[model samples]
Target: MITKGDGMGGARRHGGRPDLVRARVQQGMSQESAAQALGVTPTTWARWERGEQGVRASYRPRMAALFGVSAVEVERWIEGWSHGETSSWPTTDLGDSSPAATVKSAALLWRLEMDPSRRHLLASLPFVPSALGEWLVSWNYGTPAASAARRGAGRVVGLADVARINEARKAFGQMDQRFGAGLVRPVVVEYLNGTVAPLLRGHYDDRVGSELMTAAAGMTWMAGWTAFDLNRHGQAQQHFGQALRLAKTGDDPLTGVWALAALTRQAIHLEQGTWAVWLARAAADTARRAEAPPRVMSLILVKEAWATALQVKSAEIRDGRRAKQVERLLTEAERAYAKGTTDRDPEWTSRFEAAELNAEVGVCWRLLGEHRRAADCAEAAVTEFSERLPRSVQFNQVHAAEAYLGMGELEQALGTARAAIPVTKALTSARSVDLLQRFSGQLEPYGDTVAVREFRDHLNSELIA
Candidate 1:
């Protein structure tokens, strides 16, 4: 990605946002005149209008005054340039083709997410049912419409091909858990584009095609999950949306549940608690409507409870009923778990077992101020969760730290937080980094203490450096 002012010599006007250039033109101010008014060089002003230079924060008011607009409007212009909307900043040039072009789109979304100025654009997108409904409309009653076939007209595909796609998804999931999404996401995207896209284009019977679409949906959801873990939230959101379409095409309600649950998880991470709760509820409803297994229902309910817990503070203060509702959902999740038989669980759902439930429960308790219970559950999850799920273990450890901090056990809080540092330092998960940051925030009140200062320094060097 091209930083501001880097491509002044070769910068073109095609790719970036047009507001600045348009403003300059509409104001009828020659580049040199604008520079004179702004107390800058003609070249600098030219670069600014060309979207190749950042207008400093100090200059926003001046620039906005000159443009007869508010400083916030000027800031929006800068945000446009920063976000790659109008800039000719080169992104991953994956060539102009179906999967490759889509891959390039993914790269752009990832870049937009990484840019702090542009991230709000991703996080602020409303999680609306209309978007999901639009994707689902193409499903065509559980049949891959001929037009939906990749490669235009295609050859006979079989069950083996579908099985291979799912197996690859499983492999990617395992790699993601053991390492981090950064290690697995590119590979998954590449595989989806290079291998899976071609297979979807191939001809197959209705049964084979439906199975293939189901597998494709699962793979797409895995891609979205990895992207989410890597903090490319915009890309993840798009992938989840597409996965929903694929699931609908295959009549794969279970996979659709996965997509909605993943979306809910993303919403929660973004602190859009309302969307999270609604999406999770939608997932549970979809699961029931589709007659998904007991295990799937339990997973959805737990996810719903997690979302509800995030909303608990305000909801409890407002109506005083949300807390009880959340508790009821948690109990329902546990009852569903009791009814679930692991024998028929899919590879994806298998990870949503007792340890995960305990971790989610701990999270709910922590958020609700039940620190003692939260600490117990978190400690248990940290101890019992498999090493294969290193990222989750780090999260649980941090939750335990939060619980300790809430209970005023600073020493134990610091120790538990420090213990998770190695795990966090090794993983590329943004969520783990965010958890560590939250833990640091909990220590901010004790800034005068030696332990707090030392922990802060250690955190900066070990996790951030």
Candidate 2:
């Protein structure tokens, strides 16, 4: 029964005849009982027996343990090579900024509103926030423009939505503390889609052009993110492109760099590694051309490093050189961002630091299948986000779990993933669903087991709903 000719020229190496079914029948165990033992659904297990779907590799060990057989035996059956079948699973991964980042960012707004020190500072300064905001931005950016902005803090020119804008900005900060800063993508995108987008689409006077452009740039970036979540890849690309264009209209280099980074994320997701590197590099280049603060520029460089790592192998000559330079530049940026000895910092650059960079690099390593490096970088990222622990924390947790999965530690991976699931449920980020799907896929190896079945049912119910 081992070798059998099928449609293909190659002979199929078949395992036992529906091992789980045969074993259960031999032991006089009912289907439900067997299913429960293996953490699987009766229907799911039934499907496996009926040759509807093959089992995943992760379940092999669990099934082997339950059925008193070796994992190898379970693995053989899991492949289902009865008629010369081949498995096409992707082991290596590429990290794309998920929509969940926006949900997390929106949540931070709630937290920032509560910070008394920030409020008191605004009230006491008697200076327009734009002046202080610009000054702080300068310190982070290392630009003469920031110095000009600091000196220009002459009077209180409270713009029309100053109070509301301040409140919203504070809330954005709080989200970083609650969800983790990296998860701001969806939160920001949602705000724009629900609130900002509609406003932009409505009639507007030329007088509001600057404000409108700023808002549009932000929303366009979000659209790119939402398109990514919906898996409308081409749409996502267009959104990113629009964001960059809008940023230019506003002459907002910081926002422009931010938009380019989003483009890099899309490239990474689409498996266009070279394109990703090119995009990241261009973003950094754009930032350099701008009169942006050093902190902002650092973020762009860090992104460049991320893109390079994704597209280039460390062993390759040109790629290795570029990636190494990116890594060094990223480190430099991290050092500059965290050197917050200044009196104040712009709210925009407040989230920049070694933690975010470490998290990103960790993702880069995780995607490359460097388990040790991935886990280390992930740990560093988690540690970095420990104080904020918002949606960014959840993203990092998933990153850690992914690294654990790469290390062949399913238990840790599942446990880490579980911590982020409900804790971040209030956020409507597609990455959450993607993470759940990933976990389910990892568990599929034990198709007929109780845990796998329970999880499958749980996942199916939610996905269907």
Candidate 3:
């Protein structure tokens, strides 16, 4: 609704880690001086620039404001630097909000996600890393009682905060912020290890606290999804368990279904197809019994269909038929979505969408060697997903890249993959990174080529930048 881009003039992250460090140098700041200011080593900073390390919390703010340029602006620059592109779509403004305006500007910022030109608006604002970390504490039970109370009035509104956190978390999930797993995985881990559990155990009402615990647990599981996406299987497993407990505490059946479906998908991704189908079936059953919304049920079915397709090896020829049928099912579910039907429907139907199902099917088809169909399905997914998810439009880009690569269009694949790099810089989810990494790994054979190399090098150097 509100578009603001020009104000981002000084809000660039310098376009890559190397450029950031270089900019500090250009400003005449010596390595020692820079390290002292950010509280890190010259070597550590260099490694970060090289994408060898995660961007530490302590350094981001000071480094971002160093040249009177917002760290976000530098992050913007890093995308172009990483992908070696002069311009990219994801670097647009996310509305006209300043760092302090984030909580107030949530809705406007949400809308900015679709407006590609204003995409970088959020990143441009130098978020106080400490604030971002503590923001969760308000909703997370782990925060000290006084601290949580301080944020809220007398009693903590953990329930409401949990719901609100879910809102942010979904957008975060949809965006899969990082193009690679290295940066986002740790951020999620930090959130999980630090904020989520404490919130679950913190004092609150039986009803409100239960609901809040469910939300936290669900979000906690989401952190695992990020972990799984990042290939941190062990940590992801632990998170999933934690999510289950929290979901149960809240007596939220939908949350349970969410975790189970994730497990099913993970099983399929790991090639344990049988387990995938079994898990999906169990999840679906529970979802059906529990009265989730229509949308949620659709999502669960979509997950089941995809997992089923993968598990059906010998039945592969007919897999296409099943996939088509799944698409139809989701459409039906969508029609029922706005009717307040989810409160009446099965528990698993709350978060379903045709676009997401399409994306899932596209991946399943690609894995099944149906390249032509995969391309078609992926293209559709990219269109729908991008329309719905502005902040993380790049998620579907990975599937699109895979389809392009699978179709043997090297340049097209490379182009799409390269395009994804810049868009991914602002995201904070390991899931997005995992998808991008998959696409990049596919392009690794193209590493020697100029395009691939540029993308690789630029992304590697984006940490500090």
Q: Can you write out model 2's per-residue Cα lDDT over 1-465, one digit (the tens) per residue?
A: 334333222223344337657767877888788778878888866765654545544445567677787443554455443311332111101111111222223223222223332222111211111222232232234321111011112232223532343345456546534643346545654565455433433333333433444455555555456556545554455455555544444445667677667777766766566666766766677666655566766666666767767665543444556556656866776766665534333344555666777787787666556777877877777777774655567678777877887887877776777666664564445555676677668666666767557656765665656
**Which number leads on TM-score?**
1
In candidate 1 the C-alpha lDDT for residue 5 amounts to 42
| Poorly placed runs, candidate 3 (over 4 Å) | 1-206, 312-354, 385-392, 425-437, 440-465
Native-to-model Cα distance after best TM-score fit, residue 75 in candidate 1, in Å: 16
Q: What's the TM-score of every candidate structure?
A: 0.75, 0.52, 0.52
The residue-by-residue lDDT of candidate 3 on 1-465, one tens digit each, is: 112223322222323356666787788987777777778778866655554444533445566677677645555443333321322322212122121121112223223333334433332332122222222222122211111111322335556666676675655554453243444444554454445434443455556655565566656576667667656554455455445445544555667677777767677666666666666666667667776566666666667767766654436355667657545644554454445453355323334556666676676677666777777877786676564553235766767778788877887876776666666666554566566767767776777888778766765676236
lDDT of each: 0.72, 0.54, 0.54
Cα lDDT of candidate 1 equals: 0.72
Position 195, candidate 1: lDDT: 71
**Over the stretch 1-465, how does candidate 1's per-residue lDDT look in tens digits?**
344343322223334546877888898978888889889899887777666666554565678789998544665565554332452232222122233233234344445444444333444333343454444333323343343233335466778888889889888888888788888877887777667776776766567766777787787788778878867666677678767666655556777788888888888888778888878877887888777777888888888888888898545374347777778888988898889675656567877878898889888888777899999999999888758689889999999999999999999999999999999888878878988998898788898999999999999999656
C-alpha RMSD values across all candidates = 7.5, 19.7, 15.6
Off by over 4 Å in 2: 1-158, 161-212, 219-239, 313-326, 341-346, 383-390, 424-426, 439-465
